[model samples]
Target: MPWEGISGLVNLMGTWMTEDDPPVALHDEKAYVATPDRRLVFDSTSQKTLETIRPEGGQPVSTLKRGDRNNAAPPVVTDGSSPLLLAPFVVRQAGTGTQASRTVAELVAADAKTGKVSWRLRLDVADWTKEVTDSLAISDVGASANVAVVTLVKKGSETFSNPSTTYAVDLTTRRVLWTQETFKASVVAGGVVAGTKRKAASDEYSTPTGYDLTTGAERWHDAAEYFNTYLRPAGPDLFYLDARDRAGGKNRLRLVDVRTGQTRQDGVALASRCRYDGVGAVVCWGRDEVTGIDAQTGAPLWRLPDEKAGRVAPRVSSVWHGRVYGKTSNDCIRPRPGVTSWRTGIPSEIDLDQPWSLECRRQGKGRALAAAAGSASPGRR
Candidate 1:
C-alpha cells in the first residue's frame, strides 16, 4: 500500500510468514522496507505477532514464532529494550514443511535503511520433541541505546531440578556479556537500575537491592523497615526512591538517592506516586488531595486542595502520561474521579524550610489509612 489519507497520516505496515528470526521496524515516512530474513521486529501498533521484512534482496526474516516449551508464559515487552524480545518455543510438526511446535526468542532491531540482524539467540533446548518451560526478560539501560539486558528462564524436566538463567546481551555485538540465575527483577527510572526484592527473613522486615548495570553488582541495599527501590524521572541520580517508616499511624516520606544510597526526609507524604514539576519541586497525589513539594528537601510546595476531601481515599495515587491520564487508586486498575492525583503538587508552595501546614478533620471512614508514596515494594525474588 502507498501513503494515503491526511497530510500527516502516513503509516508503514508489514507481516512475515516464517518463524525464528528478528523483525523489521520502519522509520517515519519510510517505504515498505524489509529486514534481513534472519531478523524481525515487534510492531506494537499492530498486535503482538512479530512481522517479517526482507530488504529487497537480503535473506528472509521469520516472524510470529511460538514459545510453548513446557507451558511457560509467552514473551512480552519489558519497559525499555531495543527491537523486541520473545520467549523460546518448542515447535511440533504434523505434516510436510508444516510447523506444529517450536521454542525460540525473536529479537528485532532497526538500522539505517533496512533493519539488519543484531542477533537471533535461540533458546537452549535439550530435546527436539520433549516439553519445556521457559521465561524471558529484557531491560533497557537508559544511558546507552546500544545495550540491553536480556534474561531467560527454563524449567527442568519433572525428574530434574528447575533450570533458568539470565543473560546480559549486547545488541551491537550480538554477544552475551554475562549469564547467571534468573532473579525476579523490575526496571525503574527508564531501565537505569534493576530493582530486586531481597528478604532475608520471613518474619522480619523486607529490603530492596539495587544492582549496577555496568558490573552487575549490588550498589545499594535498603535494610530499613519500609524502604524500596523506585524509578521516577526526578534527577540524574538513577531515580528518587521513596521510603517511609511507619510507627503508629504516621508514615513519612524518606527520599533515597539511587546513586549514593542515602536517605533524606522529603516531608511530602504521598499515598502513592509523585513526580517533580520542576527542579526540587514535587507534586504528590494523596488519597484525598494533591500536594506539591520541594524536590530536594521534600517540603510541601502547594496543595491542590480537594473540593470534596471526605469521599476520596487517604492514600496518594497517580495517572501516568500516555494517550490518556486520570487518577486511580495505588493498586486499583480503574481510574475514578475521587481518586487523588499522583503528581499535582509543586515545591514552591510548601515550606520544607519550615513544616507542612494542614487543617485536620475526620469523619465516618471505610478504608482510610496513612500510606506514603515511597512504601516498600513486595515480591522481590
Candidate 2:
C-alpha cells in the first residue's frame, strides 16, 4: 500500500481471523509464545508449529530450597538472538527486613528449533529492604545487537519517580555494561541508547543522556530534550530538542543527530509528544492540530489544516511506514480519515518560553500519545 493519502475520508472496513494465543514476540519470520512455565514457537506466515516447551517439574533448586522464597514470574518480555531467545524470567527472592531481599534476572537462552536450553546468564539486578518487595521489578527493556537494557520501576505503576534504575548487559561480555539511577531506557539503536532522566536536583528541562551502545561511555546529555515532552527518535540519529530562549521568550526546536554530531534548530512549534512513524517522519500529534516532521531534516513537513484552514486532522496516534492513523473528537458523532503526499513542509510555530501562555487556534478535545514511546525495544541477538 502507498504511504500518503491526499484526502481524509478513509475508514477501516472489516476484520480477519483472530486467535486466543497470548501476544507473540515476533522475530524475523518466527513467533515465540513464552509463558512462565511453558513456551511455544511457530512459523509466522505458514502457521506451522515448530516447538513446545513444558515445565521440568522437580524439587526447588538448592538455593531456593532454603528458607528464602523464589518466584520466577512470567516472561513478560522476550527477545531473539538468532537461534536462541533472550527470555528474561525475573526471579524475586523474598528476605527478612534485616537480611535484605534480592532480585535476579536469569536470562535463559533457549534454542528455537529444539526448545532446549543452550545457555543461561544471571544478573543481580538490585537488593532492597523487605518493605520494598515489588518496587524494583523489571518494567521496561531495550536491546541492540549485543547490549540489552533492563529498566526497573514500581511493579504496578507506569511512571518511574524518585530513583529508577536502568541497567545495560553485554551478552557477549557476559556482564552488566552500566547502571543509571533516576534514568529510564527508551530507545537503543545505531550503537547508542537514548532515554530521559530525572534531574538529581533541579526540575524544568530534565536530563537527556546517551551512551555508546557497545562501550557504555557517556555520549550525549543535552538540556534541550525536556523530561515532560521527551522527543522520540525520528531515526537512529534524528530527534528534536526543545531549546528555550529565556531572554527571547521563545523555544527553538533543536534537531540533534548523534551519528553526524550535528545540531540544527527550527521553530517547528511542536508540543506534547512525537513518535517515529517507523518510517521517515516524526509525527507530532495531539490536541487540535497534527503536524509531521521530516526525519532527515528538522522541518515540519505537513500540517492538518491546509492553506484554506481545513478542520484539524484527527488526533493522530499511530504512524506506520507513512500513513497517519488516529481518531478525532468527532468520532462519537462523525469521523473521517485522510492522507497526503510528501515534500510539502509543515509550518513552524514558536511556543512561548515562559509558562502561563494559552493560544487555542481551535478548542478541540484529544488524547495524548502513549507516554512510553520507544520504551522497551527488543534487539537482535
Candidate 3:
C-alpha cells in the first residue's frame, strides 16, 4: 500500500484488487459496511482523539477528501469493536521540527454517524534529542482507559540517548500511569499482561516491572540484562533467552527464573528467540538448532534435528493455535560455515503436537530439493 498521502484515480485503479476488506474500517463495531449513514474514524498516537468522516449527501465527505497524514501507514478501519491502535508518534530527534512540530501527542475521537471529530487531544512533550522508536502501549484498568505512553518517554528526556523505557498508559484518561526507565529492558513479547487479553506494544523491554494502572507507580520489576530476550511469562518463572557476547558476535539461549539478577544459564547461549508452545512446551531456537524447552523448569524437551534451525535464527514471533511463527535474519543464533546472508522468510510454524515431524514445509521446487538433499543442503542456496 502507498505509505502516506492520497492516490489519484489512475493509481487507485491500478492498485485496486480483489482482496479481503481490512477487518477494521468503521468507527463503530456495529457499522461494518460502507454506508452513507455511517462515518469512518481514525485514532493514532500523534492524534490522540479519534477523527471521523462522513458522506455529504450523495457526494464524498470533506474529511474523506483530506489525505491521511500523521499516520505513515494507511489508517486501518475497524469495526469499533476492536480498533487496530497504531504507532503514536514519529520519534524524530528533538529540535528538528519547528515549534509547531513540538507537538508531541495527538488523538482524535470521531462521531460514529457524521464522521466528524467528537474530540481531539494534542500536547507537547518538549524536544527529544535522541531518535525515538515507535513503541506505544495502551491498556484498560477497572473503569478507565489510557491512550498514549509518550509521557514516559518525555519523563526520561535526559536519558533519551538510552531510549529504553517501559511506559504504560490508561487510554480512557489519555494519562500516563507509569514510566519505568529500564537499563536494557522493555515490555515483554506477546504484550503487557494487564488483566486477561493480550495488547500490542512498541518495544519488548526486558525488565518485568509493573506500574499502577491508574497512578504511575512502580509495583514490581525484574532486571532485563539478567535474561536474554524476554519470552512470555509463566506462573512464577519467566521464560527467556540470554545472549553471550563473544569476540566477534554472540550466542543466545533460554533460561528459567534467574530473577536474582545473575546472568548465567548453564552455559546455554541465549537462543535467538524462545516462546511458550502450549502448557508445557517452550519452543527455543539457537545457533543452528530449535528445541522445545520444558515450560515449568526450562529443561530441554526435544531438539529439532534441523542443523540449520540455528542458522535460520528466526526470532520467535508468536505461538498461536499450537504453532510457532518466526522471522529469521543474518544475526542467526547459529551461523553455518559459509553463509552470512540475512533473509526474513516465513519459516514453518513448528507444531508442538507433532514433535517428531518438521512443522514447516519448504515451498515449490525447493521442497523437492530439500527432501532429496535431506539435512545436507544449505538453506541460503
Instruction: Give each model a TM-score.
Output: 0.43, 0.60, 0.42
> Mind giving the per-residue lDDT tens digits that candidate 3 earns over 139-220?
1111223233332232221212233333444445655555544322322212232211112122322333444444544444
Candidate 2 off by > 4 Å: 1-25, 30-85, 94-101, 109-118, 127-131, 137-141, 155-160, 198-205, 223-231, 240-255, 259-271, 307-311, 327-381
Cα lDDT listed for each candidate: 0.34, 0.48, 0.32
**Better model by lDDT: candidate 1 vs candidate 2:** 2
lDDT of 1: 0.34
Model 1 TM-score on a 0 to 1 scale: 0.43
What's the true lDDT of residue 145 in model 2?
72
lDDT of 1 by residue, 1-381 (tens): 211101122112211111111121133322221211222333335433243332222111232223311121212222242433322222222333664444444344333233343345433423311334223222222323444454433332211123333345555576555543423233333223444333421212224455665556666766554423233434334334444342333344545565555665545455345544323455545455555555555555456544554333333322222101221232221222232333342111111221111211111122212222211111111
Predictions: Cα RMSD each:
14.3, 12.1, 13.9
TM-score sort, best first: 2, 1, 3
lDDT string, candidate 2, 1-381, tens digits: 111110111222211111111123445566555443334565657767666544232211122222222222222233443545555545555577786445565555566655567666665554431345444444324466757766654443222233456778776676877877666665666777766666651334445677777776778775443433344555546666554443454555556675443574455645455656555777665446667777777677777755586545654434445545443443211122233322342212222222110111132332321111111112222
Badly placed stretches (over 4 Å) of model 3 are 1-86, 91-103, 107-161, 164-166, 181-185, 188-214, 221-269, 275-281, 294-299, 306-319, 324-381
Model with the higher TM-score, candidate 1 or 2 = 2
| Alpha-carbon deviation at 335 in model 2, angstroms | 17
